[model samples]
Target: MNKEYINIALADDDEDDRFFFTEAFEDLKIKNRVSTFKDGIELMEFLEKASLLPDLLFLDLNMPKKSGIECLKEIKASSKFKEMIIAIYSTSSSEEDVENTFVLGANIYIKKPNDFEKLKKVLSEVVTTNWQYETSGLNKENFLLRL
Candidate 1:
């Protein structure tokens, strides 16, 4: 919400992925406060109680207890999170998964990169993006973050 720094959140079940995500942001010059949740249930609970919502939410599709798809549906259904940007950060790049999330109102889809350098590059591009302008021109073709 603040112009000085970005408030970023990630809901991912994998410990290594969460660690890498935070580390990537730390390496980047961008000023950001990163929050990580182990499951969608935890993430939704925090969102419900927190006064300040995250500017961007990176959601992993395979989380247990509450899948990212279910969380996306819930978030999209509520007016409270209308302004928040949802990015699907999943390892699965299946066409079905991509199509399903795109149609379900996700702002962008990012296939998880295998290497740390690639992850940093992807995160850097995502963080620096002017989401307000980008969303206005959002289309299925540009939904997925390529390389």
Candidate 2:
């Protein structure tokens, strides 16, 4: 981890979403290093070998190969990734998805905002959130971070 900035990682297949995600962090001016991956497979591969894991991870549920749900299961199953804070960043707000990811140990869930400004606001809020409190004891109510 960089001593000067928070290390944030995002895994999303959509090119446009990836662009907007990085842009939101840049505009927040919070001194964060944001790295993005195109798919869960790629993200998992990096995590397996990375010396310093990101302080937080934003994962999208749907993807062409190795869906986020699969990735979450894989991540949660391994002891090495136990402390990683994972947020379910996806367009889907399905109840099943929410409940499933919550059970799988996602730190939070966020529905993608259609407006860029809303997205920025949510991202900023998440970046500033005290994750230790939220992750210490998972609460169903706080599991989904509403914007």
What lDDT does the true structure give each of the candidates?
0.94, 0.91
Report the C-alpha lDDT of model 1 over 74-145, residue by residue, as the tens digit: 999999999999999999889999999999999999999999999999998888888889889979998988
Q: What TM-score would each prediction reach against the true structure? A: 0.97, 0.95
Model 2 pairs in collision: none
Q: For residues 1-147, write the lDDT of model 2, one tens digit per residue.
A: 326899999999999999999999989979999999999999999999999898889999999789999999999999998878898999989999999999888889999999999999999888788777766777899888886
**How high is the lDDT of residue 119 in model 1?**
96
Report the number of the highest-lDDT candidate. Answer: 1
The model with the greatest TM-score is 1
Q: Model 2 Cα displacement at 124 (Å)? A: 1.1
Candidate 1: segments with Cα more than 4 A from true spot: none
- Candidate 1, residue 142: the lDDT equals 86
